[model samples]
Target: MSNQLFIPPNYKPVLNTTRTEKAIKLTKDLFENQLSAELRLRRVTAPLFVLKGTGINDDLNGTERPVSFPIKCMQETRAEIVHSLAKWKRWNLKKLQITEGFGLYTDMNAIRPDEDLDNIHSLYVDQWDWERVITPEERNLKFLKRVVRKIYSVMKRTEYLLYEEYPELVPQLPDNITFIQAQDLQDQYPGLNSKEKEDRAAKEFGAIFVIGIGGALANGEKHDGRAPDYDDWTTPSEGNYKGLNGDIVVWNNVLQRSFELSSMGIRVDAPALLKQLAIANSEDRAKLMWHQMLLNGELPQTIGGGIGQSRLCMFFLRKAHIGEVQSSIWPESVIEVCEKNNIPLF
Candidate 1:
């Protein structure tokens, strides 16, 4: 990954007194308003922590664990910081009695152990996670495209607003976001790596919603890794192998460049969930308390995903490094380079 296109240069990030402030404030506000309008999302309360040993936690790529700390004076128990509300949102949808087409969004913060933190990646995670129910009829490609169009509309609106308020911020966003499958991307550029494919797609399409993730592709390779329990790679009620098809929420992330802002997909139902769990070799989790409920059909059939708040901020704000938006510790080499470049770590 280090040898990829993101090698840091001897460049310094200049700080403007007002641009940073205005960019962050306006972008966040627009995100809140846009997502709500697109998905009919409502702001709601979310948990800061969850009890240890309860399956009310997220398994990020099936590798990272939640940040855990012992409750004061509590024995044999600890609370875990949420990685994301991927599972919790579905549960909440049912608990809150949310009807179809109506969903909830919450500010989610988490810690990832294995992230290679850099300009786009960060240790301190913050995102907007949302989920809504869909009937069997509404689960096809058409509905997904409609929802993606709605999301892109809000993004375009926000971009226009940003340009209106700050003339310096210029982004050439297409009125309609592009649609493509992962395998199609692979066929278009067979020699390019996964990251390279993303770069090409974003650069070519301006805005795109890549689908068919989570499941392996025609070349027997998956474009990206996703937790099996969250998505259905297999079609419902068919013993046949289910193909991968998911909706991405992406756009021109940088001022003049394109990149993904979010990767969201419709979740899997019972049998497919069980199949994915087995494939991930995480069938052991199925024995856990919460997993038992889901296995027993006690959970809702819903679609959900996370949208990175800082990533979006960084992309739209046209910042070179993620540190420009949030405060966090960096390596000595990074610090020295950042200082030389006059890039504010905060």
Candidate 2:
């Protein structure tokens, strides 16, 4: 068995597979409507793939290779399955003329072939990818916190609705979320690794927003990796923070670990983009078409993020394995282990 797979001792699912399916639908509907209403987002159709070389695909963590193939038509033009709509949404904000304070949301599906499969990580990824237009003046930490609170409120509401529908599943989220910077978290737990720090914070606070990701911390290491093109990770924010992006992590009672639900931040302006690109040693990306558009001020200032759909469902339903909620291929050993443990895999 993979050492990463941790099956909670004496684990049992709250909802059976049949009932879990129904709850999944309800969970998605409740969360989607609440999130759209909370964020002023409109549901929109999104592409499964984009023409390669446009620089529209998100290079998550500046690593993982995208699943790409060539089209049979149009002289075999190469196309890449979108990693996420991070860049495409901003471009669409301009194409669709999305005004400030309004945004777009889509059901984003992706395949991360290189993902290290575990209980949480899967090759088939699904999320609610959302982006919103913002004014240049509203690109600081305060604005970011306000948006985070709004999203967390939606989460709390969704959990309440879930409880109303399924009495077996009780809501466990706290009334409010705590915010902390990567530097402070590092200082608090000087001996722990990034994941360990997150576990400690989540256990203490129930929920936390780990700010200042994608940049070097005081220890000369990053709390996490973020692609430079989409999020403004090098921007000077409150205090000694160097990034405007962060992740939402909550303590998972079922899994007994910190569970990350979303990664979000304000999109980069021309200066921030250039600075991040230079810092990442990826200055050549500035010449891409999408980069050129942003550099030339053709895209809107925006804040956007991807919230894991299956991750939320798994957490809400108290499923020990993510595959219980989402359909995906699992290794033989994992399947055997889950089966032996009475953990259903869809």
Candidate 1 scores a C-alpha RMSD against the true structure in Å of: 3.1
The TM-score values for the models, in the order shown, are 0.89, 0.99
After superposing candidate 1, which stretches have Cα over 4 Å from the reference? 1-17, 236-258
Question: What lDDT tens digits, residue by residue, belong to model 1 across residues 47-161?
Answer: 9788867677877577786678988778747999888887888888878988887888999988776677666677788888888887757665566667777777877788788
- What residue pairs are clashing in model 1? 12-341, 212-244, 212-246
The total number of steric clashes, by the backbone 3 Å criterion, in model 2 comes to 0
Worst 10 residues of 2 by lDDT: 1-10
What are the candidates' C-alpha RMSDs?
3.1, 0.8
Tell me the RMSD of model 2 versus the true structure.
Answer: 0.8
Error of 1 at 240 (Å): 11
